[model samples]
Each structure stands twice: as structure tokens, then as C-alpha cells.
Target: MRTVAGAPVRAGLPTPVVTYALMAINVAVFLITALQAQSVMDNGRGFVNPLSGAAVFDSDLFGRWVLSPLDVADGDWMRVLGSGFLHFGLVHLAVNMFALYILGRDTELVLGRSRYVCVYLISLLGGSASVMAFENGGFTAGASGAIFGIMGAQAVILLKLRRSPAPVIGVIAINVIISVTVPGISLFGHMGGLVAGAAAAAALLYAPQWLGAGQDRAKAVRIGWIGLAVVAIVTLGLIAVRAAQLRSEYGL
Candidate 1:
């Protein structure tokens, strides 16, 4: 892919290709889930429990629903990351993918594919962690948190490069405002992801030069890994606490 300037986009850089690829993956996953749902219903199966709560781990959709980090502790750990790609409805999916398309492609082009992917994944984990931290006993699904993290990383990059961040900042502000006004949004997840993105970007794009010639790159990797760890820890902690509570309350 080439930038609008007609310059050949370098290999290994963040590009529209990667952005679209991720979007396609997300969409494909959603389609598969929907199809599975159809098959289950056709076979006389029904989702008896609906997930409630904004926390990703604490939320459960019936006893069988398994798309939360808390489920991981119970041997359903896959949901820790899987939940980021799932969505509750078309509008939810569309909004996130659109945001990812617009911000992710451009950001990837600037940061290179490696850094871009790191930022995105870290942001996603951060969002999930935040949801687990604050809200319990509710099912939450969507990519808004991760997408917001991208926006946050972009803003940090602009600031680090000493470029005007007005455009990006304005966009982020608008989205945040909308999230507040809109009902059924996960404020905790979005905010957490945004903060994590900013922190990761700062560590990667800023930081003392004496750290090393490859210090920035190293920092980015560390940030991503650490962010994931933080999310996982908080999610598991919430599950343990909730489980204990349940045992006490219901004598389970």
C-alpha cells in the first residue's frame, strides 16, 4: 500500500492493510458467533442466562456463558482476550471498527506495524482490566476500549513529536463525551484503555534516550506485556472475590 503522497509504504510499518485485516478478523469472528447462535437455537437450545454488569470478567450470560476473564480462572481464560473482539450488536461493532479503520490505519502508518499492534493489544487488555476492576456481575462486550486506546496512543505520539494534537484530541474528546451521553456504554473500560494507551505510547515514544539505542522499542514491548499482566491480575482477583462472595451468600 502507498500513502496518499504516492510514496511506497515501507514494509513492516503500520498500514491500511493491517488495519483492515484486523477489522476483517473481528467481523468474521462475530459472524461465526452469530451462526453458532443460530444453530444452537435451531436445535432447541436457548441462552438461559444473560450477562449483566459492565465488567467483562464479572459479567455472565447464563451459567454457561463464557466470555469474561473471570471465566478464565474457572478454566475459561480464553475470554480474557476474546471478549475484545466480540460485540453485542451491529451498531456496537460498526462504531468500533470504523474508529479502528480511521485511527488505526493512520497511526499504524506512522508508528510502524509492530508498535501499532502493541498499542492496540495493550489498550485492549487495559480496557478489559478496567472493566473487571470496577464493574462486577455484568457481561460486557465491544472494542470501544481498545479503539479508544489507539486514539490515546496517537494523541501521545503527536505530543511527543511536538506536533499539534488538536485534531486527534478533539476527536477523542468528542467520543468520550458521546460515551458519557450514551447509555449502556462501559466508561471504566474505555477510560482504562485510554490511560494504558497513553502510558504505553509515552514509554515507547518518549523516555530518556540514554535508556538505549533500542530503548523505545524495548519499552513498548515491556509496556504491552505489563499492561496485559495488570489486566489479567485484576480480572482474576475480581473473579476470586466474586466466587467467595457467591459461596458465602448462597452456600455454594
Candidate 2:
């Protein structure tokens, strides 16, 4: 059956627990960032109405939590993880969370919890890594990268299941269009997330078969872990090299 989330959910699939949890986590982090921003903006009090366009930024809070390629080079690599949970404004937070609620549900169901989590992390970090490697320094924050990653993974699932991949591709195309037409979207971040998600999903699904990880379930499991470990290392190494290049070229 066709679905907007890229594939149909089966009749008896358990609730998408991981999906719900991720949405909750994103919302929670946004709350923290919002409070921090409010304190920064309003004489150390509560949040401002972003809808009123009166919100002020806390550069210190943003720099600490948002992903900055330069900050990453200086050993604040944790920002890569934190940035996915941060957002520029309430509208940004709302849009990303909504998208996550939609895509994460079907994705977690199809990929299962463990692989779903891995794909999300890979996509998120991949986007940060790309931002670190290519973009100029700024406070880049949002879960769109992870969301794009889910979209890519979902497309892969539909293709594997012999379903048309057009809907996902179309969604991606529309997103790219919007990103280009609108201001402030991270293009490379989205691209990196989508590619990484697709790669991670393919690795998870096919590594066992490719490695001939046959009847020995234990052996197959080990191989899968090993493959992911190798990919993680490679990802870090590439990011380091690119980041170094950026620093050296710009003298930053």
C-alpha cells in the first residue's frame, strides 16, 4: 500500500517507539534552547514571542550549541551532535519536528530501532561534517539533515520492496527547490544527510548478503558492526582532513 511516509505500515507493527522518542527528544531540546534564548533576550527571564519577530539571539548560547565548523576544529566537536537538536527559531523547530513525526514513524518501523537510530545519527553527523568541511562558519542548527536522511532511507526501502521511488525523489526535489528559493537553509547539510542515510541503510541491508554472512547469525552480526565501525572511522577521518583544509586556507 502507498503512503506519504514512503511506505505502508503493516497491520501488526508495534508502535514506532523510537520514532516517538526521537520526536520527544527533539522537542525537549528545543525547549531548553528556547529557555536559554529567552533568558538571553529578556533581561534574564522567559522566552519572547518568536511569532512577533521580537526574539533576540544569544550568540554565546548559539555558539555553544549550534554547529560551527571553526568551533569543531577547535575541539568543540560535540556541537555536531547538539546542533541537530537546536533551531534558529520557533518556526524552524516546528517545521523540523513535524517532518520528523511523519517520516520517523514509518522509517523506524521498516528499519527497526537499532538501524533506524544508526541511520539518523549517521545522517545528522554527516550533515555536520559536510558543514564543517565546506561551509563558512555560522550557527547551523536544525534536524532537517536527519529528516532528509530518513527520507533517503525510506526511498531505499521502497525501492528494495519493488515500489516506485518517485514520491520520495519528488519530495527531495521540492525540498531542494525550497532551500534554493528560500534563505537560510543548509544545502550541503541536506545533501550530506541524504547521501549518508542512503549509504547507511544500504550497508545495513546488504552488507550481510554481500559479505556472504550466511547461516552464522553471530558472524553476520559481528560483520555488520565491523562494517559500521569502519564507516564511522572513515567519516571522521574525511571530516578531519577537510576541516583542516578549511582552516589552513582561510587562516582561521
* Candidate 1 wrongly placed segments (more than 4 Å): 1-15, 39-75, 208-252
lDDT of 2: 0.74
Residues 97-146, candidate 2, lDDT per residue (tens digit)?
88998899878877767768888988888888778767865557889988
Q: Among these predicted structures, which one has the highest TM-score?
A: 2
Say what the RMSD of model 1 is: 6.7
Reference-based TM-score of each model: 0.71, 0.83
Q: Lowest summed-lDDT stretch of 10 residues in model 1?
A: 54-63
lDDT of each candidate versus the true structure: 0.64, 0.74
Q: Candidate 1, after superposition: displacement of residue 186 in Å?
A: 0.4
lDDT (Cα, 0-100) at 143 in candidate 1: 79
lDDT of 1 by residue, 162-221 (tens): 789899889888888887899878888898789777766665554433244353554544
